[model samples]
Target: MKLKMYFLLLALGALTLAFQSCDDDDNDGISVPAELQNALAEKHGNAQRIEWETKGTYYVADFYEDNYEKEAWFTKDGVWQMTETDIPGLAALPAVVKSAFESGRYASWHVDDIDKLERKDVETVYVIEVEQGKQEMDLYYSESGIFIKEVADTDGGHNSEGYLPSDLSAAVRTFINENYPDARIVEMDVEKEMTEVDIIHENKAKELLFTPDGTWVSTSWDVRTSDLPGAVTAAVQARYPDYVIDDADYVETKENDYYWVEAERGEEEVHVKVTAEGVIL
Candidate 1:
């Protein structure tokens, strides 16, 4: 399996917010659920260009806060799940959190990106990305200063002199150039199912898996609720007006499109299945 590791660059005093996607009107034609709008207004008062979608069972709001980019996740009924804020330095983290983070295996790795992920009942945690040579890892720490787990690990061997192939798709090449400009392909393997390439970025290493047509296929990236289609989000909101969606997963097959949604109201949580036509099955 090819692992993908995405880390934010630590640019000091950079007041501009450079989002992953530049399209501000992406959510214009899509209908925003009233519950979602109210939730955004309540939690993210200053958030701009609030774009939303159903991700898993959460309604995710992707927006800009101050000079930094932020993403907030809420249940369909408007209960908040978590919010992530881009930050700089370990100084912003709690003393215990920083201590636990520094004690991890990748402690000496170069700091690539840092963010604060806050949830209601759970302790606040820091999502940190670090790089060492061509090796990169993402670490998570609790507010009480305990290492939670390593979210992603992209370290691999860098001797690709005999592995890398000359023929690579434009999309694959562009993805690497834009995301990992400082990285290089060190190893390549062609399997019966898909093609995989080992890469090293600033000493950190990771392998990439691509389909026959060069479509990236890997779980290295976490798909947020905001990444779902608008129709799915709208359908979820309409059908479960009384329940708050906690997470949602879209399932596809040759015959049907189905959504598995987890919802909550007060202390009761229920899982519901909905079809593409907005009918709860």
Candidate 2:
């Protein structure tokens, strides 16, 4: 009996020592560091407390608001902190990124998905992943926050342009300034059949048909004398050769097509319309 008791007591002591060693190791090695804690606090100022969880290979830090619900996450190494922003579709963007989408009038825009791509010409250009309704797209930007391009969108689920959050568009003017300088957009009627853009000195008007997903389906152009079927082209060139064509577009009619031209002169602009036939109408 004495020998059995001695053996049991020895085993208990060994178990206790092992548990103590494990506790010490956890406290010393796994405890949050002071510097990293400070950084996490700075990144999530609104966080009142953090609860940690082991999700496979990662540790998820659930930022709790008043200890009620989990809000955001920070990696074990203190990366990918969430901030507040009101971008329309993607709730994951930080407030700064949300501000970018709102400023671009993209809130009302619909998207299916977004993709970030790997293409570049200069440091100024950046890729942004955008999904508006049913269409997914990659929107590019410059270092100065200017819009660069709507690179491409495919039937595949990949529509994102692979730029980081630091790269996003904020306004239509920014998009136009970076991409198209001589082009002036006169109308964008959602109910209308097309979106019209005017190339003033070039005597060209382009109308792009857009899908509900904001995809450009077709692009139709009106040039002064392109041997096209439109009648307005013939009439305007014959009347004003030296005046310089500023803007021109055609409206379809039951009989034929009509072309209208406008030119910017000092302060006023000259407006002319030509009928489908070779008439000075």
Per-residue lDDT tens digits for candidate 1, residues 178-263, read: 86786645434577878765555453335567787877765122223676466666777776678877766655334565677777
Off by over 4 Å in 1: 1-29, 89-105, 151-281
lDDT of 2 by residue, 73-191 (tens): 34466654332111234454344444555576455665444322222211322334556656666554333343433445565544121121221223433444454566544223344
- Model 1, total clashes: 19
**Every model: Cα RMSD to truth:** 25.3, 16.4
The weakest ten consecutive residues by lDDT in model 2 span 159-168
TM-score of each: 0.40, 0.25
Q: Give me candidate 2's TM-score against the actual structure.
A: 0.25
lDDT against the true structure, per candidate, is: 0.64, 0.46
lDDT of 1: 0.64
Model 1, residue 39: displacement in angstroms?
1.5
Model 2, stretches more than 4 Å misplaced?
Answer: 1-36, 48-134, 140-145, 151-281
